[model samples]
Target: MSFATPSLIDAARSVLIVVDIQERLCPVMTDPRGVLFNGARLVRGARRLGVPVVVTEQYPKGLGPTMHDILSELGDGASSAVIEKTHFSAAAEPLVRQHLESLGRRQAVICGIEAHVCVTQTAIDLRAAGWEVFVVSDACSSRRPESLTAALTRFPAAGVVPVITEMVLFEWLADKNNDGFKDIMSLVR
Candidate 1:
Protein backbone atom coordinates (compact mmCIF):
# COMPACT_ATOMS: atom_id res chain seq x y z
CA MET A 1 0.00 0.00 0.00
CA SER A 2 1.35 3.39 -0.99
CA PHE A 3 0.70 6.57 0.95
CA ALA A 4 0.44 10.14 -0.33
CA THR A 5 1.92 13.17 1.35
CA PRO A 6 -0.39 16.09 0.64
CA SER A 7 0.94 19.63 0.60
CA LEU A 8 -1.85 21.74 1.94
CA ILE A 9 -0.30 24.86 0.41
CA ASP A 10 -0.72 23.44 -3.07
CA ALA A 11 -4.41 24.33 -2.84
CA ALA A 12 -4.14 26.72 -5.75
CA ARG A 13 -3.86 23.63 -7.93
CA SER A 14 -6.57 21.84 -6.00
CA VAL A 15 -10.33 21.57 -6.26
CA LEU A 16 -12.90 21.01 -3.48
CA ILE A 17 -15.21 18.02 -3.93
CA VAL A 18 -18.41 17.59 -1.92
CA VAL A 19 -19.75 14.10 -2.53
CA ASP A 20 -23.23 12.66 -2.10
CA ILE A 21 -24.53 15.04 0.51
CA GLN A 22 -28.04 14.67 -0.79
CA GLU A 23 -31.26 15.59 1.05
CA ARG A 24 -32.07 12.15 2.40
CA LEU A 25 -28.49 11.26 3.33
CA CYS A 26 -27.72 14.43 5.25
CA PRO A 27 -30.51 13.99 7.77
CA VAL A 28 -29.32 10.55 8.79
CA MET A 29 -25.57 11.21 8.71
CA THR A 30 -23.78 11.24 12.02
CA ASP A 31 -23.25 14.82 13.07
CA PRO A 32 -25.21 16.35 10.23
CA ARG A 33 -24.99 19.91 11.54
CA GLY A 34 -21.21 19.94 11.77
CA VAL A 35 -20.75 18.30 8.41
CA LEU A 36 -23.11 20.68 6.67
CA PHE A 37 -21.59 23.78 8.28
CA ASN A 38 -18.05 22.70 7.61
CA GLY A 39 -18.83 21.76 4.03
CA ALA A 40 -20.37 25.17 3.47
CA ARG A 41 -17.42 26.96 5.07
CA LEU A 42 -15.01 24.95 2.99
CA VAL A 43 -16.93 25.77 -0.18
CA ARG A 44 -17.02 29.45 0.70
CA GLY A 45 -13.31 29.43 1.44
CA ALA A 46 -12.58 27.61 -1.79
CA ARG A 47 -14.48 30.28 -3.66
CA ARG A 48 -12.52 32.99 -1.86
CA LEU A 49 -9.29 31.43 -3.08
CA GLY A 50 -10.63 31.03 -6.63
CA VAL A 51 -10.43 27.25 -6.35
CA PRO A 52 -13.06 25.30 -8.21
CA VAL A 53 -15.70 23.32 -6.27
CA VAL A 54 -17.44 20.21 -7.58
CA VAL A 55 -20.47 18.54 -5.98
CA THR A 56 -22.22 15.25 -6.71
CA GLU A 57 -25.68 13.99 -5.91
CA GLN A 58 -25.90 10.21 -5.41
CA TYR A 59 -28.96 9.43 -7.55
CA PRO A 60 -31.24 12.35 -6.97
CA LYS A 61 -34.27 10.19 -7.73
CA GLY A 62 -34.01 8.34 -4.41
CA LEU A 63 -31.77 10.57 -2.30
CA GLY A 64 -33.13 13.87 -3.53
CA PRO A 65 -30.92 16.74 -4.71
CA THR A 66 -27.92 18.05 -2.85
CA MET A 67 -29.12 19.77 0.31
CA HIS A 68 -30.63 23.22 -0.21
CA ASP A 69 -28.13 24.92 2.14
CA ILE A 70 -25.19 23.54 0.16
CA LEU A 71 -26.89 24.26 -3.16
CA SER A 72 -27.49 27.84 -2.12
CA GLU A 73 -23.88 28.33 -1.12
CA LEU A 74 -22.69 27.16 -4.53
CA GLY A 75 -25.19 29.57 -6.10
CA ASP A 76 -24.77 29.08 -9.86
CA GLY A 77 -21.18 30.24 -9.67
CA ALA A 78 -19.07 29.51 -12.71
CA SER A 79 -16.39 27.98 -10.51
CA SER A 80 -18.88 25.56 -9.01
CA ALA A 81 -20.10 22.55 -10.99
CA VAL A 82 -22.76 20.03 -9.96
CA ILE A 83 -22.70 16.54 -11.39
CA GLU A 84 -25.51 14.04 -10.97
CA LYS A 85 -24.10 10.55 -10.63
CA THR A 86 -25.38 7.01 -10.31
CA HIS A 87 -21.89 5.69 -9.67
CA PHE A 88 -20.43 5.64 -6.17
CA SER A 89 -17.11 6.96 -7.31
CA ALA A 90 -17.60 10.43 -8.74
CA ALA A 91 -14.28 10.10 -10.52
CA ALA A 92 -15.81 7.37 -12.69
CA GLU A 93 -18.31 9.85 -14.05
CA PRO A 94 -17.16 11.38 -17.35
CA LEU A 95 -18.18 14.96 -16.70
CA VAL A 96 -16.59 14.94 -13.26
CA ARG A 97 -13.26 13.94 -14.77
CA GLN A 98 -13.77 16.31 -17.66
CA HIS A 99 -14.46 19.24 -15.38
CA LEU A 100 -11.36 18.51 -13.31
CA GLU A 101 -9.24 18.25 -16.42
CA SER A 102 -10.71 21.44 -17.81
CA LEU A 103 -9.76 23.33 -14.64
CA GLY A 104 -6.24 21.86 -14.66
CA ARG A 105 -6.75 20.86 -11.02
CA ARG A 106 -4.69 17.83 -10.14
CA GLN A 107 -5.27 17.85 -6.40
CA ALA A 108 -8.51 17.96 -4.41
CA VAL A 109 -9.79 18.25 -0.86
CA ILE A 110 -12.88 16.02 -0.69
CA CYS A 111 -15.71 16.30 1.85
CA GLY A 112 -19.19 14.78 2.21
CA ILE A 113 -21.34 11.77 3.18
CA GLU A 114 -20.86 8.04 3.65
CA ALA A 115 -17.14 8.36 4.23
CA HIS A 116 -16.62 4.62 3.99
CA VAL A 117 -18.52 4.22 0.75
CA CYS A 118 -18.76 6.93 -1.88
CA VAL A 119 -16.06 9.10 -0.32
CA THR A 120 -13.64 6.20 0.02
CA GLN A 121 -14.21 4.91 -3.50
CA THR A 122 -13.91 8.35 -5.04
CA ALA A 123 -10.68 9.00 -3.13
CA ILE A 124 -9.14 5.76 -4.33
CA ASP A 125 -10.33 6.20 -7.92
CA LEU A 126 -9.24 9.82 -8.03
CA ARG A 127 -5.78 8.84 -6.82
CA ALA A 128 -5.57 5.96 -9.27
CA ALA A 129 -6.46 8.41 -12.03
CA GLY A 130 -3.43 10.52 -10.97
CA TRP A 131 -4.94 13.16 -8.76
CA GLU A 132 -3.80 13.95 -5.22
CA VAL A 133 -6.87 13.42 -3.05
CA PHE A 134 -7.25 14.79 0.45
CA VAL A 135 -10.27 13.67 2.38
CA VAL A 136 -11.33 16.34 4.85
CA SER A 137 -12.35 14.06 7.66
CA ASP A 138 -13.90 16.66 9.92
CA ALA A 139 -16.21 17.82 7.18
CA CYS A 140 -17.25 14.30 6.23
CA SER A 141 -19.65 11.91 7.98
CA SER A 142 -21.49 8.65 7.60
CA ARG A 143 -24.72 7.28 9.05
CA ARG A 144 -22.47 5.68 11.62
CA PRO A 145 -19.36 7.22 13.14
CA GLU A 146 -17.65 3.86 12.80
CA SER A 147 -17.86 4.07 9.04
CA LEU A 148 -16.12 7.39 9.07
CA THR A 149 -13.54 5.91 11.41
CA ALA A 150 -12.90 3.00 9.09
CA ALA A 151 -12.32 5.31 6.14
CA LEU A 152 -9.87 7.45 8.06
CA THR A 153 -8.04 4.28 8.96
CA ARG A 154 -7.80 2.90 5.44
CA PHE A 155 -7.62 5.81 2.99
CA PRO A 156 -4.02 6.88 3.60
CA ALA A 157 -2.53 3.86 1.92
CA ALA A 158 -4.73 4.52 -1.12
CA GLY A 159 -3.09 7.96 -1.41
CA VAL A 160 -5.75 10.03 0.26
CA VAL A 161 -4.75 12.33 3.12
CA PRO A 162 -7.28 12.55 5.92
CA VAL A 163 -7.37 16.12 7.12
CA ILE A 164 -9.37 18.66 9.08
CA THR A 165 -11.12 21.66 7.55
CA GLU A 166 -9.08 24.42 9.24
CA MET A 167 -5.78 22.83 8.29
CA VAL A 168 -6.64 22.99 4.61
CA LEU A 169 -7.86 26.58 4.87
CA PHE A 170 -4.80 27.94 6.69
CA GLU A 171 -2.39 26.05 4.51
CA TRP A 172 -4.11 27.42 1.43
CA LEU A 173 -3.98 30.98 2.68
CA ALA A 174 -0.33 30.42 3.74
CA ASP A 175 -0.07 33.75 5.55
CA LYS A 176 -2.30 36.42 7.05
CA ASN A 177 -0.66 39.19 5.01
CA ASN A 178 -2.99 38.49 2.13
CA ASP A 179 -6.36 40.24 1.97
CA GLY A 180 -8.35 37.02 2.06
CA PHE A 181 -6.61 35.81 5.19
CA LYS A 182 -8.80 37.74 7.61
CA ASP A 183 -11.97 36.50 5.97
CA ILE A 184 -10.74 32.91 6.05
CA MET A 185 -9.63 33.26 9.66
CA SER A 186 -13.09 34.46 10.63
CA LEU A 187 -14.65 31.46 9.03
CA VAL A 188 -12.26 29.09 10.76
CA ARG A 189 -13.08 30.66 14.11
Candidate 2:
Protein backbone atom coordinates (compact mmCIF):
# COMPACT_ATOMS: atom_id res chain seq x y z
CA MET A 1 0.00 0.00 0.00
CA SER A 2 1.21 3.47 -0.91
CA PHE A 3 0.27 6.50 1.11
CA ALA A 4 0.82 9.76 -0.67
CA THR A 5 0.27 13.06 1.08
CA PRO A 6 -0.98 15.05 -1.89
CA SER A 7 -2.22 17.88 0.28
CA LEU A 8 1.31 19.02 1.13
CA ILE A 9 2.90 21.49 -1.27
CA ASP A 10 6.57 21.13 -2.07
CA ALA A 11 8.46 24.28 -3.04
CA ALA A 12 10.37 22.47 -5.77
CA ARG A 13 7.19 21.08 -7.29
CA SER A 14 5.08 24.23 -6.90
CA VAL A 15 4.31 27.27 -9.00
CA LEU A 16 2.52 30.33 -7.67
CA ILE A 17 -0.11 31.79 -10.00
CA VAL A 18 -1.44 35.26 -9.30
CA VAL A 19 -4.62 35.62 -11.32
CA ASP A 20 -6.28 38.83 -12.42
CA ILE A 21 -5.75 40.91 -9.33
CA GLN A 22 -5.80 43.84 -11.72
CA GLU A 23 -5.70 47.60 -11.28
CA ARG A 24 -9.36 48.36 -11.93
CA LEU A 25 -10.52 45.13 -10.36
CA CYS A 26 -8.92 45.53 -6.92
CA PRO A 27 -10.84 48.52 -5.61
CA VAL A 28 -14.20 46.79 -6.17
CA MET A 29 -13.42 43.56 -4.34
CA THR A 30 -15.09 42.68 -1.03
CA ASP A 31 -11.79 43.04 0.83
CA PRO A 32 -9.26 44.58 -1.50
CA ARG A 33 -6.69 45.55 1.07
CA GLY A 34 -6.68 42.16 2.76
CA VAL A 35 -6.53 40.34 -0.54
CA LEU A 36 -3.66 42.42 -1.83
CA PHE A 37 -1.70 42.17 1.40
CA ASN A 38 -2.06 38.40 1.63
CA GLY A 39 -1.45 37.95 -2.08
CA ALA A 40 1.71 39.99 -1.84
CA ARG A 41 2.83 37.95 1.15
CA LEU A 42 2.41 34.75 -0.85
CA VAL A 43 4.39 36.24 -3.72
CA ARG A 44 7.17 37.39 -1.43
CA GLY A 45 7.34 34.07 0.36
CA ALA A 46 7.34 32.14 -2.91
CA ARG A 47 10.28 34.16 -4.17
CA ARG A 48 12.19 33.67 -0.95
CA LEU A 49 11.81 29.92 -1.33
CA GLY A 50 12.76 29.99 -5.05
CA VAL A 51 9.30 29.07 -6.33
CA PRO A 52 8.50 30.23 -9.85
CA VAL A 53 5.52 32.58 -10.25
CA VAL A 54 3.14 33.25 -13.12
CA VAL A 55 0.88 36.30 -12.99
CA THR A 56 -2.14 36.61 -15.27
CA GLU A 57 -3.88 39.84 -16.16
CA GLN A 58 -7.40 39.26 -17.44
CA TYR A 59 -8.33 41.45 -20.41
CA PRO A 60 -5.65 43.97 -19.55
CA LYS A 61 -6.98 46.55 -21.98
CA GLY A 62 -10.32 46.69 -20.20
CA LEU A 63 -9.29 45.68 -16.69
CA GLY A 64 -5.87 47.40 -16.53
CA PRO A 65 -2.65 45.73 -15.46
CA THR A 66 -1.80 43.72 -12.39
CA MET A 67 -1.93 45.83 -9.22
CA HIS A 68 1.16 47.82 -8.26
CA ASP A 69 1.60 46.02 -4.93
CA ILE A 70 1.82 42.62 -6.63
CA LEU A 71 4.02 43.89 -9.44
CA SER A 72 6.33 45.53 -6.95
CA GLU A 73 6.91 42.23 -5.16
CA LEU A 74 7.84 40.46 -8.39
CA GLY A 75 10.70 42.95 -8.88
CA ASP A 76 13.87 42.26 -10.86
CA GLY A 77 15.05 39.37 -8.71
CA ALA A 78 11.87 37.30 -8.78
CA SER A 79 11.50 34.31 -11.06
CA SER A 80 8.17 35.27 -12.56
CA ALA A 81 6.21 35.58 -15.80
CA VAL A 82 3.27 37.78 -16.71
CA ILE A 83 0.52 36.58 -19.02
CA GLU A 84 -2.22 38.74 -20.46
CA LYS A 85 -5.46 36.79 -20.75
CA THR A 86 -9.05 37.30 -21.79
CA HIS A 87 -10.32 33.93 -20.60
CA PHE A 88 -11.93 33.57 -17.19
CA SER A 89 -9.93 30.41 -16.69
CA ALA A 90 -6.22 31.12 -16.98
CA ALA A 91 -5.77 27.44 -17.79
CA ALA A 92 -7.89 28.00 -20.91
CA GLU A 93 -5.36 30.46 -22.25
CA PRO A 94 -2.95 28.63 -24.49
CA LEU A 95 0.02 30.66 -23.35
CA VAL A 96 -0.78 30.13 -19.69
CA ARG A 97 -1.21 26.40 -20.16
CA GLN A 98 2.03 26.21 -22.12
CA HIS A 99 3.96 28.26 -19.60
CA LEU A 100 2.68 26.20 -16.69
CA GLU A 101 3.50 23.00 -18.51
CA SER A 102 6.97 24.27 -19.30
CA LEU A 103 7.63 24.86 -15.61
CA GLY A 104 7.17 21.10 -15.03
CA ARG A 105 5.60 21.65 -11.62
CA ARG A 106 2.59 19.59 -10.59
CA GLN A 107 1.43 21.77 -7.72
CA ALA A 108 -0.12 25.20 -8.30
CA VAL A 109 -0.61 27.76 -5.55
CA ILE A 110 -3.27 30.22 -6.75
CA CYS A 111 -4.52 33.59 -5.49
CA GLY A 112 -6.41 36.44 -7.13
CA ILE A 113 -9.57 38.50 -7.72
CA GLU A 114 -13.18 37.69 -8.69
CA ALA A 115 -13.27 34.50 -6.69
CA HIS A 116 -16.49 33.25 -8.25
CA VAL A 117 -15.38 33.96 -11.75
CA CYS A 118 -11.81 33.87 -12.93
CA VAL A 119 -10.28 32.42 -9.79
CA THR A 120 -12.78 29.59 -9.52
CA GLN A 121 -12.64 28.70 -13.17
CA THR A 122 -8.86 28.68 -13.23
CA ALA A 123 -8.65 26.44 -10.18
CA ILE A 124 -11.14 23.98 -11.57
CA ASP A 125 -9.49 23.87 -14.95
CA LEU A 126 -6.03 23.46 -13.47
CA ARG A 127 -7.25 20.67 -11.23
CA ALA A 128 -8.89 18.94 -14.17
CA ALA A 129 -5.67 19.20 -16.07
CA GLY A 130 -3.92 17.19 -13.34
CA TRP A 131 -2.27 20.00 -11.39
CA GLU A 132 -2.60 19.86 -7.62
CA VAL A 133 -4.42 23.17 -7.10
CA PHE A 134 -4.41 25.10 -3.84
CA VAL A 135 -6.34 28.36 -3.74
CA VAL A 136 -5.40 30.87 -1.05
CA SER A 137 -8.72 31.73 0.55
CA ASP A 138 -7.83 35.07 2.11
CA ALA A 139 -5.90 36.13 -0.92
CA CYS A 140 -8.91 35.70 -3.19
CA SER A 141 -12.07 37.82 -3.30
CA SER A 142 -15.15 38.78 -5.26
CA ARG A 143 -17.14 41.98 -5.64
CA ARG A 144 -19.58 40.56 -3.10
CA PRO A 145 -18.99 38.49 0.02
CA GLU A 146 -21.48 35.82 -1.05
CA SER A 147 -19.70 35.29 -4.33
CA LEU A 148 -16.50 34.64 -2.48
CA THR A 149 -18.32 32.15 -0.28
CA ALA A 150 -19.79 30.45 -3.32
CA ALA A 151 -16.41 30.02 -4.93
CA LEU A 152 -14.84 28.53 -1.84
CA THR A 153 -17.78 26.20 -1.43
CA ARG A 154 -17.34 24.92 -4.95
CA PHE A 155 -13.62 24.12 -4.52
CA PRO A 156 -13.92 20.78 -2.77
CA ALA A 157 -16.14 19.27 -5.45
CA ALA A 158 -13.84 20.64 -8.10
CA GLY A 159 -10.87 18.95 -6.49
CA VAL A 160 -9.27 22.28 -5.65
CA VAL A 161 -7.88 22.53 -2.15
CA PRO A 162 -8.67 25.77 -0.37
CA VAL A 163 -5.77 26.94 1.79
CA ILE A 164 -4.61 30.00 3.65
CA THR A 165 -1.52 32.12 2.97
CA GLU A 166 0.42 30.79 5.96
CA MET A 167 -0.41 27.19 5.05
CA VAL A 168 1.23 27.69 1.69
CA LEU A 169 4.27 29.45 3.17
CA PHE A 170 4.94 26.81 5.81
CA GLU A 171 4.28 23.92 3.45
CA TRP A 172 6.68 25.40 0.97
CA LEU A 173 9.22 25.97 3.72
CA ALA A 174 8.46 22.52 5.24
CA ASP A 175 10.94 23.11 8.07
CA LYS A 176 12.01 25.94 10.37
CA ASN A 177 15.64 25.25 9.63
CA ASN A 178 15.32 26.12 5.94
CA ASP A 179 17.54 28.98 4.73
CA GLY A 180 14.65 31.36 4.00
CA PHE A 181 12.85 30.65 7.26
CA LYS A 182 13.51 34.07 8.80
CA ASP A 183 12.73 35.96 5.61
CA ILE A 184 9.54 34.01 4.92
CA MET A 185 8.51 34.26 8.57
CA SER A 186 8.44 38.03 8.22
CA LEU A 187 5.65 37.69 5.69
CA VAL A 188 3.64 35.61 8.15
CA ARG A 189 4.26 38.16 10.87
Q: Which stretches of candidate 2 lie over 4 Å from their true place?
A: 1-5
**Model 2: which residue pairs collide?**
none
- Per-residue accuracy of model 2 over 109-180 as CA lDDT, tens digit each: 999989999999999888887788999999999999999999999998778899999999999999989999
- For candidate 1, lDDT tens digit of each residue in 77-168? 89999999888988888888888789987897899998999999999998987788889998999999899999999986777889898988
Please give the CA lDDT of all the candidate structures.
Answer: 0.87, 0.91
Clashes of each: 0, 0
Relative to the unseen true structure, what is the C-alpha lDDT of residue 39 in candidate 1, on a scale of 0 to 100?
94
| TM-score result, candidate 1 | 0.95
Lowest summed lDDT window (length 10), candidate 1: 1-10
Q: What is the Å distance of residue 103 in model 2 from its true position?
A: 0.3
Q: What is the overall TM-score of model 2 with all chains considered together?
A: 0.96
